[model samples]
Target: MREEAPRTVTAICRALQEQIECGLLPQGGKLPAERQLAEVFDTTRITLREALGQMEAQGLIYREDRRGWFVSPPRIAYNPLVRSHFHAMVGEQGRVPETEVLSARIVPTPAEMCARLELPALSSVIQIRRARRIDGRLVLYVEHYLNPQVFPGILDFDLTRSLTDLYASHYDIRYGRVAFDMVPTALPAEAASILKVTAGSPALLITRVNRDQHGRVIDCDVEYWRHDAIHVSVEVPD
Candidate 1:
């Protein structure tokens, strides 16, 4: 019957999911090639891929750009409510965190970012771009836009280190009240390339608009995180 296709795909997906959860497919272990898996399951490649897609969506597995699917590692717990920076948070969870500055320069603020930073047209913002990794796997790519006036000569500082510490010590400025917005998105080409994933891979976009001590908009950060690499956590205090 026509209705059998969905049932077949769901069965394949559950079988693979069980393998992953039961540790038969170890974390970071590459899955067998598509053809091999299809043969093993005695199903069409199309059906196998459909099943794999379900696993990817459920965060049980992931695919790299050129590399095939692999069992995912434990997700990093991300608490947007916490003030700690990337390195600190990863360290607290006993995972290695690495950041590399991709690019840094002064650039005319893009219209969308200009609004977020509350800057006027033709204004310049110090833009620093970086890619972050966890446990030796590429995970996040981020772009930082800062009001040039507020952070004079910001480019001189090492951009790979924590922005929070850079200004806290150099400019006597600390992160003040902040706002966070998160959305599900497909990774852009640039971000996906840097993170070693296929373009349009699933991603989580977190936009942070930060204000200074006096309540003035100081900077904004746009972060693209590999969906399977992070677990969003928010704890409410009683």
Candidate 2:
């Protein structure tokens, strides 16, 4: 018989991250006690503490003095292009909006993403690819990168649901400032498949990054809007 290698805290954290993202553990809920978690993972309490510490730093869980650790709520959505929720945009047109969370995971931030986030060095980012629809017709494709350390359980929430409401109700995030950059581009191969469009089709590529009240980077995203489908009319504040 072969002996198994002892589990480390990093491994435990990754497992927990995966579970949270997959909804195995519900959001805003308490995590298992240290003793129980250690036993479950076949690890030591010290290692479990280390793993929990990393998660705490990432805003995934908070430890009460007497109580145990609990998962943090989901983050809010603030569009730099306009002062509106994607849901609100569809609602105004007398259309219902639906979202399909295509893909999501935790990975090292790419160079471009690091620059947008203004992160010092390489950092972990939460990657989310989703499609937005109006009247059951696909209209918008979004790729969002959030600071994994700042928005824990990001993978756990039902992303088909509205993230904007989740941020406000769970984390008390009010609103965010907006900045946008737009470009004309041909649709990439992968994006075309999900958007149900032909490759190299004309599209509007808009990049945006959101900041909180304290000026912390909350989220950065790129949106691909089909040129033939929808155009926007904006109203400025008085």
Candidate 3:
């Protein structure tokens, strides 16, 4: 029985993968309920969940809180080397992009953020929290920390607009030096909850730090993305 269950889970994963790839399970389509699926597979709910998790980690599917699993849409191609903001990049990929400003306020900088921005201890920065969706599916939760000295009264504007455009038109500041650090990590509870996934779900964390034209560190962003939602592609000129 033990050996039989392991093979059954593998069989279930394979069968569903084929179905999804063949378009029987269309992208963005919700999967049957766990109980229904378990019955179809002739397996217990526990085994079915294991199979679903395997597929989720493989970027083949995703699960929402209180909603069942869903066939994942095509992953967005992200080229970090290019200077593009969230909305621009999503639009270029032929996907509808939307952002919701969760909160924006001046917050005392934490030690880690202060060091990253090279700001003096105890300095506060404009912290903007946002949730972004692609094709109307929540996929990213991000926070922007900007040097208060560089952008005064920025909080007065609509926070959902691209920061890249605002930097040029509102402040006449262009990014000169930028750096990115990426790592595979477990999504924090705050971000995962906002994305409608379970806490500690698999995710990719991309940390971006930027300097203005005069070499002054102006802002940094911590972006938490659904691991399956983006395919990072960097293009280089030879």
Per-candidate TM-score against the hidden true structure: 0.95, 0.63, 0.98
How far off is residue 171 in model 3, in Å? 0.5
Instruction: Give the candidate number with the greatest TM-score.
Output: 3
Can you list the residue pairs that collide in candidate 2?
Answer: 21-155
- Clash pairs for candidate 1: none
lDDT of 3 by residue, 109-213 (tens): 989999999999878889999999999999999999999989999999988999999999999999988999999999999999999999999999999999999
Instruction: Report lDDT per candidate.
Output: 0.91, 0.74, 0.94
Ranking by lDDT: 3, 1, 2
Stretches of candidate 1 above 4 Å error? 1-3
- lDDT (Cα, tens digit) per residue for candidate 2, span 1-238: 0132234766888899998898887776789888999899887777788788778656566454456776655432333446667888667666677898989999888899998887757788989999987666565799998887677886888877776777777667645676688787877987776777567756679888887767778888898875544555555678
After superposition, the stretches of candidate 3 with alpha carbons farther than 4 Å from their true spots are: none
Clashes of 3: 0
- What C-alpha lDDT does candidate 3 achieve relative to the native structure? 0.94
Question: By summed lDDT, which 10 consecutive residues of candidate 2 come out lowest?
Answer: 1-10
1 versus 3: better TM-score goes to = 3
lDDT of 1 by residue, 160-212 (tens): 89999998999988888999999999999989899988889899999999998
